[model samples]
Target: MARPGVPAPPPEPPRVGITLQQLRQSQGLSLDELSRKAGVSKSMLSQIERNQANPTVAVVWRLATALGVGVGELLGDGRPAPPAIVTVPAHGTPTLKSPDGKCELRILGPIDLAGEFEWYELTVQPGGALESEAHEPGSREHLSVLAGTLEVSAGSDTSRLKAGETARYAVDLPHAIRNTGKTIASALLVVLHAA
Candidate 1:
């Protein structure tokens, strides 16, 4: 498939181990801590970070998840940065489904805001609930219902919000949002991280 007098494309560079090490350190995570969060053995992670071992796809996936980054961010070519203006179409947005499969959340914010903050469009089927564990201290969540009715509960207090209603609550304690109406519930949710 080569054209006359044209050179073949250069091969991809070898994976750089420093990327992983830097990310872990920047997050103030030790090898043991990252191992526990990634579900990978500490020894294996050590090896990978030292370029002594080649990680499998699953291992890389777990590491990416633990680092709160995409796998491409780890293996991307070490080239100059591109322009800052980025666009994410609706079809390209990342989505997460609840464990029970009755709720869906579409990430609407930039990926760089993963930890500091996040925005999402959440949809819950009737009779479904989205339960969440306590977030970082001082973190809060704001939800504005766009359709149907939602029961927002934080700890012992619960409130009902209908279409065009909004509620803000501290998320440092266990919380849940249940769709109490017979129709699907849609809401815009913004989570602010603790300073």
Candidate 2:
């Protein structure tokens, strides 16, 4: 709150559309090309560029992946240098949830390294599962249980894990981390993509 006679802070400028357009133009990419690469419709891209549409988080993630840039870079000025020490507030971290709403994943890795390597703090309610399809060939994941008990399945193999236990498994095939315990479960999950 501002004191009497004190001015309030200025509002932040809208930058998403501008930044998207600039990145597209700077990369010499046409609307059709970007749409194809980002797996977004050209019409939607045009709307986004014209500030007529506000994209969802999934759309932004796809755009960032196609541009080979971080989500922050797409949302802010390009690739700003980090300070000696950087702190991202807990609330500022991005999160993804399962469609069933029983599992939540807090993204913990820098977006720039998303495809190569990524980490997440995962929480699953009792009887919930974090299931995933095959990843890129040779991709692997490591899960270190932090609370409660969980079960991990990679292809045909499965193992139960308790707090303080870790499991490393290939994720190129179908995989899942299920919380079959009576309480919530937490784990640190790290994924390493193929070369």
**What is the C-alpha lDDT profile of model 2 across 114-174, one tens digit per residue?**
9999999999999899999999999999999999999999999999999999999999999
Choose the strongest candidate by lDDT: 2
Per-candidate Cα RMSD to the true structure, in Å, reads 17.9, 19.8
Positional deviation of residue 43's Cα in model 2 after best superposition, in angstroms: 53
Scored by lDDT, model 2 comes in at: 0.91
Task: State residue 170's C-alpha deviation in candidate 2, in Å.
Answer: 0.3
- Model 1 Cα lDDT, one tens digit per residue, 26-115: 678999999999999999988887889878888888988998877887765533134255567889999999988999999999888887
TM-score of 1: 0.57
Which runs of model 1 end up more than 4 angstroms from their true locations? 1-85
